[model samples]
Target: MLIGGGHSHVAVLRRFGMRPMAGVRLTLISRQAETPYSGMLPGVIAGHYTRGEAHIDLRPLARFAGARTIVDEAVGLDPRARQVLFATRPPIGFDVLSINVGSTPDVSVPGAEGAVTPVKPIDRLLERWRAVEARLLASDSPCTVAVVGGGAGGVELLLAIEWRVRHQLAAAGRGAGHIRYGLFTDSAHVLPTHHARVRRAFARTLAERGITVHAGSAVVKVEPGCLHTADGRSHRVDEVFWTTQARAAAWLRDSGLSVDDRGFVRVGDTLESVSHPGIFAAGDVAAVDPHPRPKSGVFAVRQGRPLTENLRAALAGRARRGFRPQRRFLSLISTGDQHAVASRGPFALEGRWVWRWKDRIDRAFMRQYTELPPMRAAAPDAAPADEMAAPGQVPDASMRCGGCGSKVGASVLDRVLTRVKQPAAGRVVIGLDAADDAAVAEVPPGRLLVQTVDFFRELVSDPWVFGQIAASHALGDLHAMGARPATALAIVTVPYGIESKMEETLTHLLAGAVAVFDREGVVLAGGHTSEGAELALGFAVSGDVAPDGVLRKGGLRPGDCLILTKPLGTGTLFAADMRGRARGRWIDEAVASMLLSNGPAAAAFIAHGVSACTDVTGFGLAGHALEMARASGVGVELDLSALPLLPGADETLRQGLVSSLHSQNARAADAIANAARHAGDLRFAALFDPQTAGGLLAGVSCAGAEGCVAQLRAAGYPSAAIVGRVTPGEDGERWRLKIGD
Candidate 1:
């Protein structure tokens, strides 16, 4: 498992992409979907490069590398359990782990965290930079911006910010003369790590720009609008940006890993943790004890290949190799305009040509990830040998038993259940706590019991997220019938692995389901677990509804308007995602839509006097809508253009990417009168794109339809819209659906 989408990890992903290892399931856990290329950050700040050009999207990269990515921050590490803990999800196990989570600027000063914005974590910095530009553009008064730190990063960042802000103001027809700049550092000179000549050149440029330099002054305290230095000097500033020395994440030291005084993981020449085996560290988060080097992107980029080799060696149980970082390397620092300075030890050069050269180098490095070649399927005969837990580390698949032997071990199952926070007993009588063979639930008086079952193999690699989606999907049926969910019984099939691995996977999956159930006030009763070739999950959900309040698909009237509670196109988007053709943001939006429970929308529909209701699920919109229409004994006219679509849906459909069941669902288009005429349209194609955990489709009177949609949107179903209208049908209407403009 890779912990961060840092500079080194991106390289590691690229290498693994070019030549993937068989049987080694790679997973990347990152805080953000995209990680900025530090080398091009100053260029972006200076308006020389677009943000997209300076950032690498880890989703496509991870998929191309045959790796699953979990977009989350790692909060802690359980060395004993070999698991990585997350704040919002259950812990995930990793056989071999690597850490490349880069550092943030040291914000140790009093009140600094609240007053000064650190210039690391370039994504957040860029967001703040945009705000700073907007604030300056709108201000008519003089504004003083202070930068703390004397190193190359601080100097370059300050100049870049100044240039961008000034340019923006000029474009807005505002005077930039009111803007002032100040640089403070404990070091006696700027570019403290650079050659003396380079420092002198920058100092001269700063003076020419009228920027004040407070050398040998350390910021002791920072207030909202003022800062105090160690030398008893106070400087009033509008905003303060920090670009100080890097600091490690606090969890590293707490994880019992050997760390330096500053909390950075200590590693040897091989980049492996000195205190722990099977764990590696790199990037700014790691301090090489054998040969200490300054924390810089260049070093991290250089360590990528060595880290990959060592990690692969460790995983394969081969002898590990050592890597010694170079003592000196070339540095190219841009001056926020079209010029830059190049320095290598005592050698220094300054010219616009230097900036062009640096730009070329940076873009080339980024292209390795952004301009990846199309992935090809492996040949049958050329497939690499399975490396799943070495040769004899686990029981052979053929030798494994069947029947009751396939069930998960009792102790492992118990441990997982003990840790999982099951939903509170609301309607459940004999639940998990009772350890009964069958779960028993009680139905409240005057309410009828409603039950539905759903099961599917993992579409997503993260068990935690998949669990949530699966549970939400099963519950979608209950909501469609206008029922309040009361209880759920899980059915889990875990891939064969060691006892501990099985426990961790089951725990994560259950925890995710329980999180959704608890939020919806549904109890998780007893369930079953069994070994399988692939991970799968399902739930038998039970709900309660008043007999008079239950909504059905056959209640639609001729004048009713059809309302869809969410967007379509999860099918095409995820299919494209599997092939690395979809963007990260698109998948993110799709996941958000899937996680949105249809319960609120269902309640809103019922409140608005909805006549009929059904959820858009695996059968696609066309099939489900046809089912509703046929059952209501009426025809329907759907507005092709009115259908809401998820992001990137059209692009994927146009590329002929779709879920495997799309063809089967498309057969329902025969029920549409204009199927042939609109066969080529992407929107028409979307009608047949199967969805997972999708929205609610309902029929409401014309007057109440608009109000019902309004209520749904206010309740968080923003895409809810009237997509069609029910029409009067004859006794034998062969084609009951028609597409409208």
Candidate 2:
């Protein structure tokens, strides 16, 4: 498993994707969906490169690698337990692990932590940059900005900021004369680590830009509107940017690894942790014990290949190779304009051509991951391990070819499906519906049986959580028909493992499902079990309802209010989760939302006089809602903004996260009015995100919509809200989905 979306880890994922090791499962857990390429950060600040150009999208990369990317940040590691603990969720087990989590800025100075923004964690820095730019644009009076480091990172950042501010002011018909910039460092000279010629060139450039260089004293403290230096002097500035030091994350030290004083993992020449076998470390978060090198992107980028090779070998118990660092490497330091300085082992040059060279080199490096080779679709919603399935063609490639692949240890269903007998004529109380979970029977005195089945490959690694979600999902059609759950038959798949291990896994998986079954007062009937390559579960459920009481999708009135009893974006968020790009909290919240039962929400709708209702599932809100609309012969206008969303759903959509089933779901966009007008909006894109075990989307009377929402919220669904209203379009205009943002 790869812990972090660092440069080396991306390389590892890409290589494995091209040549996957059969029977070896890989997983990547990261805090964010994208990892910034530090090489072009200055150019980004100077507006020379867009944010996309400066960051690597890990989602597609993980897909190409065929790796399950868990979007969670590591908090600690239990080497003995062979597990990595997350901030949320239970600890994930890994046979082998590698750490490439990059370092952050050492923002330890007084007031700096809260007031000043650091240059590291480029994502946050860019956000702060936007705020700074906005404040500058609105300020009528002169404003001062200070950078707290005089090293390469700080110097380059300061120059970039100055250039960007000046150009922005000029663009707005204002002047840069009112803006003041300062560079603070404890050192006596700028670019102290660079050669004399390089330092002189930057110094002259800074002087020309009218930026003050405060070299002798450091920024001892950062204040709200100024900075305090060590020399008993305070420099008043509107914004102070910290970029002085690179500090390793404290979590690494607590992970029980052999870390240096700065909390970075100490590694051998092979980039493997010195104290931990089968655990590797790379990038700024690792300190090489054989030959310690300063924290720089140069070393990090070069470590990728060696780290990948060594990790593969170590995992397979092969002899590992060592990485030899280059004594001197070329450095292309941009001048914040269309020019740069190149330095290597006392040799230096400067010009616009140098900047072009740097841009080419950076883009070329990014292209390795950005312009990746085509990979098979890694659909998160594809029948994971046979927990659930849909009839006919699977748009997702992952679910295809499940003939023999679908079979388990024995011919469990052959006897039942193939064994046919002559019908007992009128006495045949129940007719055979082999496809249905349970057959409908002719009962006396107005009675009917409702049967439904649900299964899908497991989404989460936790079997227990998967069990609950799968069982809850089995009630989708039953709840849609306003039927009460009665009994269920489970079909489970366990990976080929030891007898004890298999039993334990099955126990946890069934226990979780049974607990939920008991809550809904459903019985656990006999089911089938088999061994497979991965963990999966499925359930065939039967519920009961009156013949005339079955809620049909066609029951809708023009004036009915549409109520959505949950948020959207599970499909996209989980898709993002598989790319290791979704936030942990976002996944956690999405899981919690999925576990929510629509039984209560459906009851609430029925109590308030339901018109038409259906639980949103794999087809997504737009697809399922359109189904309801078409079935009811009505038009619907959804207030795009009013559609309740899970936390980070909008952000994930904006970040370009869409599920494998998104294309299929989005195929229904034609049913939407003004689709093109809102195509660029992230909220509109969410309409295509597939949901699993999602909330109930119901059409109810306008008079009862408010009270229905209140009852649903009070019943534990705070996210439930009235999203749209039914319209009068059954035939001529067809079904229409109007979006209001």
Candidate 3:
């Protein structure tokens, strides 16, 4: 599993993509889908590079490497068990692990964390930068901005913000005279680590740009609108950006690995953790023990190739290779207005041509990730479009919809619901076409009512796919309780756009949902719709169950075998998808499984006379299984390896990708009996992998467990597996799991 989408990890992914090991599977876990190239960040702020131009999209890179992309943050590590813990998911096990999570900026000064924005984790910093830009453009009054630190980063960012603001004003026929820019440093001179000549060049440039240089002024504290220096000077400003000291994630210090006082992982010359074999650290997060270096993107970039080779060798049980960074390297720092300064040791030069050289190198580096070999299947024919509205013609949501007129247009609703004909069952005495406020249902003499409601914001980028998954997921509740689905009431919220486009999108979505409804023989009664910020869908589904026959979670008995009807890992995969970290094929496969109804699986369980069941959803397998185990007053001995998994799940888990709900689900670890003993096994991570329209988890009689699994496979659930068995439990027994025992 590869953690962090930092420079070295990207190199590792690209190499692994080009050449695959016969039996090795790779997973890339990243906190963000796109990592901003540190080299181009200043250029981006200066408005020379667009967001796309400056970012490396780890999604395609991970896919190209045949790796599963998981978007999440690593929280801690258990070296003895070989498992990496996350803030929001179950611990991920790995035979080998590498971290390149990069360093965060220090915000240690009182109120600094809240008052001033730090610079590393460039994605968030970029977001704040845009807001500052907008505020500057929107304001009629003058503003002052301060950048703390005399380092190269502080200097470049200050200049870039100034340059971009000036150009924007000039473009709008306004001059930049209204804005004041300042740079404060604790040291006597800026570019504290660079050649004297280079510092002189920037000092001259800042003076020329009319920027105030606050030399030897250390910012000791920050307030909402200003900062105070250690010398007792208070500088009031509209915005304060802190870039003084580099800091590492606290999780590193907590991760049972050797780390420097700053919390950066301590590593050997080879970049492997000095104390933990099979686990490696790189980029700013890794502090070389013998030869420590200041954190720089250039050094991280240089580490990529060697990191890849060493990782491959270690994975294949070969001798590791040594990669020592050069003692000196070229530095081309942009001055924010298309000019740059070049420094090599004591030699330094400044010119526009230097900027061009730097730009060429940066763009060339970006191309490696952006220009990937396409892998999607042949494109389908385009859907016919209604004439699009001209720019700015899309209606503002607030302008419409306080009354009945705000509802979806009757004609459009009619067109969309034409496919949702009522089922021929007598349970529906009055249906959708009747146009009543609500539909009437008849409960059979021996049946009890079961109702469930579910709704969510769109997951997939595609509307049709989103609709299908929503509908299927809503019905999963009934399937878990062994109820026969009967009808549904849909509540939809569609974004305000061109009338024709909105209608078309809604039609596709409803059609997709109706297809599933038709298969399950469920009728779409009626519901409401409204204009909203984004498209969202939900359902209040009603099903039937015989009171005596209903499957409650508390029905499990000792000696019953546990059967999981489908695979795990939908949560992390979808979370990755939301960030564009997951691959298309991975999503396609997940959707296919999601759309595969739990109807048949429910029936298979019912046929085997099993009453203990629950569908694994956002809480993950471990969570739902624990629910069943605890409620039934029994313990579950899960054979971790026997659990079925969706394609890319294990890979994504290894890469540290997990859903936002992963942490909550992982909390169920308190219920696992033997987790710590075998927590390092990568397969165990699947337990906390959340599912969308996931499979059924049930306890069947030991005598019928194998037969029930056979029946489920015969019913089209080929991935179904007998994963565990219910065991005796004392009120206070400790472990409830036996993973890879």
Candidate 4:
């Protein structure tokens, strides 16, 4: 699975989606649904385009490519096990893994924590923009905005905001001078890193916009309402945006991967991670050598084709080709007003038409994925001239089967096990490859039996991500039951491949699964492996939930408040993901949500007086909630607006997107009190959206609901919330999903 849906990886996803590798499964893990294109962000901020116009949809890309999508952040890597562990969900196994998380702004500067918002992540910057805009709209006063760093990003952003604020003011019948903009840099001039001609253009633009440019001024501290410079100069500001020095994500430095001084992954020309051949790095997250290039989206975009090629080769155990980056690339910098400056080497040009050219290039790149070519239909077979032919073309083939039906065929499993030796054991009664119905274990008199089984097909294509989700999903059963996991038996199946390919596939998958088990004090008990046409995993786990304090699904009571530990919508998101229509940031957000295990949430639920609970999985909120309500002989009134949905879930549903399993889930909504009333609401549809490695749905007392949610959020389950309440059942049959006011 590709981790971090940044620019480079988005390109890789699109290319792979168009023409996938025959036997390879692709998955993408990201923290956001829409990854903003840096090149168009200024245009967006300047009001020339909307947010959607500047972002790439990762969900549709994954769907179109038949890849799985895991929305999560990778926490660590177990190279030996070929697994990537996430903070939330299970560890993901992969034959090949790639990282393109991109860089974070250097917010480590003094006093930056409270004073400035970093622009590197893009999301934070958008939020800051909202806050600034709101404040300006709330009063008839001028707003002062300060931007740190005088590089291309900083200059462009300052101008964009200036133009947007002024435009908004004029639209509101206010004076254009209602907003003040400033740019600060620890350099002799603005755009110090660019050519003199480029610098001159930016200087002229800033002057025309009446933006104050502070050169040779080093910021020492960021105060609440002002930035204090090293020379004891303080500039008052309503909002401070960070666009200064950029660096790799902090997690990369300790990930055991080879990194440069700035902590970016060190990669060769082929974009392979320096220390691990099976791992690759690209985009702003990677530092390429032989020609040290600046951290620009251009290089990341160019590297996508070669990176995808090398990943396929690496997985196939073949020699990989190198990526050759252009020595010089055209730089088209927007002026936030339908005009732009173009620079090639030392040469330069500027005009409104240049901006139009830049716009066409950016839009065309986006269209390649959005407006995909339809798959060509197979030709009809020849028959006698008199034979009648159908007037219309045949319907496209049905999508591949999913769930249990997608399991590996029996013959393929047996053949692979025949060549492997079994582990030696004295007391072992059941062994892998024995074709037994259930695993057999010896139970001593004093020891109690703890059993948990987890099964799920690939939700995403990236091996590492699939490994994480699989492991996390397996571990959830143990955590839910309050068990200290003892050991795990993995049942993994990969697409058929050569010996080396099989080895790599098994290695990465086990690595990811093992990493999760290892962290939970569990051992890898011997299990089975086989080849199939798709990837799937199941774990028969044993753990010790204290005999005196076992948590079960049938413990809820009336008068309890319902709490959800994480956001919903993996099903709808993944459905959209398949079409390559979901945005990168949305996929990222989904994966992050999935990777988050219910371990912590479970503990908090129990401690906070949780009466009953169940992890929200394939059946979704309404389906699972119905289960709890029926089991407890109580009725639930779910506040639809209170639902914590994954990013882009509502939008996707509004667009009529849904998971393959959504129909079955919607059928289960018959238990709902007024399903028809919410039949047309997109937000309500998400109530039936199937989830994988989702959150925990708990029932707590109404009085403790707010406090419990606060505690959960404080304990790191930030998305936790009180989604509804339980009450005495009306006729003891109906569960209601109320769209609250």
Candidate 5:
């Protein structure tokens, strides 16, 4: 599995998707659904391109690669166990793992937290840009902007913001000089990392734009609306953008891998982690080679080929090849507007045409991902008998079976478990074994058995990722009941395939499932399997909860706050996935959200006196909410605007795309109190989009609702929100659901 959808990994995914290695399953894990390429970001800011044009569509890429993309942060790593742990979901197991999580600006500088905004993690920078634009548009007075750091990123951002703001001002019938731009650098010149000739060109460009250049002035501290320099001088500013000292993500330091002082993963020429051979690091997160190289996107881009080769070699149990990175590369710096400066060693060129060249190069790079090659039919010699089997004997590619009919073969399941080292405990009675039909466990007296089963087909193509989401989905039921999962017996169905392919699929799928089970203190006991035409997975999980600790679905009382742990919309995106229309990033986001188990949310809910809860799954939010309402004997009033949606879901719905189960889900809307009153709202229509491994919808007491929501958000469930409220039921019959504006 590939972790972090940064620029370099994107290239690797494109290459692998175009022509995948047989017996290898590719999976990508990222924190964001859409990964913005830095090369086109300045143009986006300068209004040369729209967001869609500049941003890569990760969903299609994932589809093309036949990879499952998970959108979540990797919080920890167990190289010894070959498992990657996420903050809110199950651990992911990988035979060969690669990291391309790009660097972020150093935010550890004194007063840096609130005084200045860092421009790395392009998404946050874009958000800050929007806020700055709003402030500028809201005022008639002049605005001052300061960019700290003399590097290319800082210079480019400063110029881009200047050009965009000025053009916008002129269009508004205002003076172009209404905004002031300043560049601060510790070095004696701007573009300090580049050649002298390149620096001179940028220096001249800054002067021409009437921008103030403060060289040899390191920002020691940042104050409200101002920067304090080491020279003991302060520069007043309306906003401060920090693009200095790019560093690795802090999580990497604690990941138990060998890292340099700067916290970047230490790798040899082979790009394999010096400490962990099974794990590899690349892109900005890696410290490369025989000679130290500056952190640049160029190196990351170049490393894609070698990284892919090494991963394949490692998986095949073959010797890995070393990657000899080039010592120097050409640099292209944008000067806002449609102008750029190019540097190759000592030679420097600046003009509008240079920008055009840069644009062409960047677009060419993006095209590698956006435009994919068509899948070719197998050659006559390579085609298997099954491919040419008679009509009655051959399985249809479409219209897959549901339920237990779609499971992995028993033989394949047996082989995968041979690799896993089960934890040994006398008390841990239930565990994976060859002869057991059902997991047998010895529960202590006074502990009640909490049993729940959840199953679903592959919403995504990647088996490893499907495994994670399936595990998380199944565990949600246990979590909602405030139970500690003890053991799980997996039920997996893999598509009919050759022995090699079947083994590979089962390995990744079980690895993913087992990773989650391990983290939740659940043991993987034996379960049944069979061959099928499609991939599906589930777990029969048993948990333990104190007699009084069980939270039931019918205990919800009137005046309770309804809190949703994660956003919705996996079903719609996956529906789009079948048509090859969903963007890679969109699918990535959906998978990430689904893979997030409701464990944390459930824990928080129980701690805050949650009365009742249920996970939103195959049923749409409205359908699930109705179930809660019916069970609790109460009425629910949901604020449409308060609903949290997965990114890109609204666009998919606007495009008239929906899951296959949507119609059935929509039929359940009959239970909604005002279904006809606001039938025209597109947002309301999305209430019927079936979610996969969705969030926990809980009804908590009003007294602790605010604090519970806050705690959930701080726990990395940023989309967690109080979506609705529980009210007294009208009659003896179950309940009602209302959509409020």
Candidate 6:
């Protein structure tokens, strides 16, 4: 498992993508989706490069590497249990772990936390910078901006800010003289780690730009708009930026791994943790004990290949190779406006050409991960034994059994069931609590039975999350029929693995499903589990409904309003995710949408006296809507512009990224009256985008439509909207759908 999306780890992903290992499941746990390229960060600040151009998108890179990504912060580690703890969710187990989370800016100075913006976490820095820019654009009086650090990062950043802000001001009809810049450092000279010639070059450049340099001045304290120096002098400033010494996360010191005094992991020459086997560290979060070097992005970038090689060896149970640090490396410092200085050893050069050279190098490095090469199909190979087989066992398909022999071991299933909490007993007569051949359930005398079944392979890597989605999706059918769910039987298929591994997987999957069942008052009756080539889950759900209260697709009335209880786009989003084209935030939002239960929305619709209702699922909105129109024997007119969309859906569809089921669902478009005229719009594609655990589409009385939607939004269906209205059935136009503006 990779712990962060840092410079080194991105390279590792690229290399792994080019050459993958069978049976090795890779997972990345990161706090953010995009990681900034520190070398090009100053260029971004100077407006020479856009933020997108300076950051690496990790979602696609992980996909290309065939790795699962968890966009969460890692808070702790359990080396004893071989698990990594997160800020949320259960701890994830790993066979091998690597850390490249990078370092944070030292913010221990008095009042620094609330007063100054730290420039280490590039995402946070960018957010704060945007706010600072807005304030600067609105200010008319003179303003002072101070950078607290004399290192190369601080110097280059201050100059970049000055250039970009001054240009923005000039374009807004303001004078550059209204802004003042200051550079403070505890050291006597800027670029203290660089050669004397490099320092001289930057010092001259600063003086030429009229930037005040307060060398040997340490920031003792900071207030809202002022800072105190160690020399007993107070400096008034409108903003303060901190780019001081890098610091490790405090959790590292307590993580039980050998760490230095500064909380950085102490790693050997092979980049493996000195205190723990199968654990590796790289980037600013690691301290190389054999050959110590300063914390710099260059070192991080250089460490990529070696780290990958060592990690691959570790996983294969081979010896790790040592990596030696270079004595000197090239450094390019940008001077804010397409000009830069290059220095190596004692030599220095300055010109616009240097900046161009730097840009080429930076962009080339980013393209390896961003503009990925096409992936070739995997070759037929032997089943992997690393994670699949236990001691003294081998993975061989010929040795596997058929029929009842394919079922999971009775002992394993019993243990997993014991570990997973069973849902509270409901209408279930002889369910999991009893050892019965079949589940028996009873229905109320006054209510009719509403039965629905749904099954699908996992769309996500997290089994727990997948379980929630599967249960929610299955329940959607009953909710659309306005029934109260009572009992469910789960069908599970897990990949062939060791008994212990299979047990753990079953426990998590059952636990996730049971959580949803307990909340919805549904009982988990008995189910079946068997070994398979991959993981899959499903449920057979049964519910109760009043004989006359059943909501169906045939009750639409003329002039009724159409309300969608959730946003569209799970189909396209997950499709894009598989192809490595979707952003992490987009997938995160989509998962959240899928996990939402349709129970509340169905209740709201019942209360609002809906005429027709059906939950949109595998069939896209177009197919489902057509089903409603055909059943009601009416022609439906849908306002194309009014349809609600999930975030990133439009862009993905525009890029032509769609699910495999998309083409099948689009056949429903043939029933549209004017498909040819509106097919060009990207929103038109959304009409046929298949969804999982999608929202309910309901027709309500025009008088109650507005209130129904308002209440749905208040009940957590924020995207619920009036997408269209029911129209009168035309004799020859039965099942017809109209697309309108």
lDDT of 6 at 634: 83
Off by over 4 Å in 1: 378-393, 421-424, 729-735
Name model 2 segments beyond 4 Å from true.
376-453, 459-492, 497-530, 538-554, 561-610, 618-691, 701-741
lDDT of 1 by residue, 401-433 (tens): 878898888998888988885744798888888
Give lDDT per model, in order.
0.88, 0.79, 0.81, 0.76, 0.80, 0.88
For TM-score, the strongest prediction is 1
Q: For model 5, how does the per-residue alpha-carbon lDDT over 1-741 read when each residue is reduced to its tens digit?
A: 788987778877877766667656577888776788888888888889887777777766766666766766888888877787876444667768999988988868688886777887788888899899878876877778999888888899889988888888888888766678889999999887788889888888899998999999998887677788989998888898889888888778887899998899999998999988878888889997464788888888888988888887887778999878877788889999899999888788989999999999999988887776753443111223244234555455455455675555456566677755456442356556534555678776898889988777766665767788788888888887888888787776766655545666777777778778777877877666666656788888888889998877777889999999888778777777665577866776777787776788888998898899888878888998898888877888888888888887888888888888898989977877778988877778778888777888899998899999999998778899999988886664349888875
Q: Which candidate do you rate higher for TM-score, 4 or 6?
A: 6
Candidate 3 TM-score versus the reference: 0.57
- Judging by lDDT, tell me the better candidate of 1 and 4: 1
- lDDT (Cα) of model 3: 0.81
TM-score of 4: 0.66
lDDT value, residue 403 of candidate 4: 64
Per-model RMSD to reference: 2.4, 10.1, 25.9, 9.5, 8.5, 3.0
Clashes of each: 0, 9, 8, 66, 13, 0
Cα-based TM-score, every candidate: 0.95, 0.73, 0.57, 0.66, 0.66, 0.92
For model 2, how does the per-residue alpha-carbon lDDT over 33-124 read when each residue is reduced to its tens digit? 67899989999989999998888877667767777656667888988787888663446667678888888889998888879888877888
Q: Give the backbone clash total of model 6.
A: 0
Worst 10 residues of 1 by lDDT: 378-387
User: How would you encode candidate 3's per-residue C-alpha lDDT over 189-249 as one tens digit per residue?
Assistant: 9998888899999989999998999999988888888888989999889898878879899
* lDDT score at residue 370, model 4, on the 0-100 scale: 68
